[model samples]
Target: MRCSSWIRVAVASALLVFTASAASATLVVPEPSDGIEVLVSSSCRDRLDVSLRIDEKSSPGELVFTLSITGPGSTRGDLRGFFLNLADESLLDGLSISGPFVTGSQLAANAVIGISTGYTAKSHRHAGGSSNPFDLGIELGTPGISKDDLQTVTFTLSHATRALGLADVSGQTFGVHAMSVGKGRCRTGSCKLTGVIPVVPEPGTALLMGLGLAGLALPGRRRA
Candidate 1:
């Protein structure tokens, strides 16, 4: 088959796959693939600019997550708490998490995984004055991740009975609280970062689109 003809076919296939994936409620980031990156899109989304990367681990029903700041070149902050909601509330009982700086846990109306060295109601209080609750909350210790850095904590989430999959955690609500954001006189005391699932074409989709465009340009280039 001609290169241009094959490129056309590839573009069509990519479009079909992209449409089908979008129709589903859950976005699957399969094992070994780059995890879904959820960015902070709250009032402080730009200022704090944090992100949560969720990936499926090798172990059955296990998922690994990393949280980090991603803007302003530099900043200073400590993650006070991390909050999330499971597909179902009952999953909370079997859920297990392990990470650095994780100290305690809390389950109120929703699951709150406390991750603080000195856990306190005052510290866990949601920054930005929002009362949104979560199915799980992780209280982190002091000296959290800072600018241009992915540090402080990397944790795994697993269940007991359920072999958790994309349906169990994908497209779920999540939030993070940070203290002392910014640096060199630009420091703000604290800010709340909430999850914003981005809608982007898969890499394959983008490559297909690029090929289709290139194919269209090829004949013109030859004629020139």
Candidate 2:
């Protein structure tokens, strides 16, 4: 009977470890909307290009964006490129940009941009024409983030400029329709942005395990 009891205890302990490992391995996005949109500008014209960086806890992941622009001027741009890093000042390790496309006199600039791997939200800008590019970056910390925690980074633009023959200039209104990034590939027809899951373990889980081990080590003689 003693041997069988010991065996059962061993099996239970092993199962507990396995269950914890499996549960901890899976990363999840708790928010219903995988993506969040951040408005960057209300108006830009004369070929405006902007670049922004997104900071994440994980080493490598994916960034997806849905860009929208509205005005008489026909122009559109993608997420283009990104730089990521573990620290704020560290040299950028990975960078990626999307292929450029012309809006072709369309009323709106709507498109998707995808990026892979390491990047930092340090400095960003727009490329091309007499228009000066804008720089933007983001900082990330470990407060509410856990292995299962997922967050959305959003970018938005809402304005445009038009040239009115010779010295005349005109401005139009626009806004960000949507912006987001996620760990896994976005499924088709999904409007929300998704971000990659961080790899850190949950503090609560670790604390619970520590308590369990302490309980198992308690001596019956001491309790009595």
Candidate 3:
């Protein structure tokens, strides 16, 4: 085929695919459900937030998980360590934790992880408050977050793969259970906590859409 002919075909194919994708079924996020919550103390908040969300860009056998914890107090930059139990334990390697928190495990496993939250080694726990965005307390070797204010700590992990011991989690009923967190004035492990289960779209739907796009982009000739 001529260069101009090939170019025209490519443009037409791309436009057709784009239009089809736009008109066809597209993923839409559902209404937010009340996530799990925990308690700080009798004088503190009624509930603490422990939320989890899976990325829509997850591929086969891999998942992208983002977690956040909204506490009842601030002022104290106490670095809280939230111990969570993932649905797929082997896939733990795929997650990279961030925020005013640290991973119970390695930061980099088999995923292309990126983080831009707060961090302080257990060695410099209480001294690195000025280094973080939240001039809060550092609880490394010192006191944890104080009371009387609402504090939220969140983080994102991208490109989480299921190579270690898992696979695609699409509509597979995954969960993020809050096991425990760092110690502090009021919010301790003794505080009561509830787990959250965020839902994801079925993998079959995503896969069919992907196959359609692939077929459009790379159509094959048929013999008569």
Candidate number with greatest TM-score: 1
Clashing pairs in 3: 61-167, 61-168, 76-137, 77-136, 77-137, 78-137, 99-118, 125-140
Candidate 2's residue-wise lDDT over 93-133, tens digit each? 12222322211111112111211112221211111110222
- Would you list the C-alpha lDDT of every candidate in the order shown? 0.53, 0.21, 0.28
Tens-digit lDDT track for model 1 on 14-75? 22111211222212223224445555533342255566666654555678778765654665
* Model 3: residue 22 alpha-carbon error in angstroms: 41
Candidate that beats the other on lDDT, 2 or 3, i.e. the better one:
3
The digit string of per-residue lDDT tens for model 3 on 101-211 reads 433333322221112233334422212111111111211112333431213344443345434212233212211222123335433431222221222323454444445
Q: Which stretches of candidate 2 lie over 4 Å from their true place?
A: 1-31, 41-60, 71-91, 100-224
Please give the RMSD to the true structure for each candidate, in Å. Answer: 12.9, 23.7, 19.2
Model 3 vs. true fold: TM? 0.32
Query: Alpha carbon lDDT of residue 47, candidate 3?
Result: 33
TM-score of each: 0.62, 0.21, 0.32
lDDT for predicted candidate 2 compared with the true structure: 0.21
lDDT of 1: 0.53
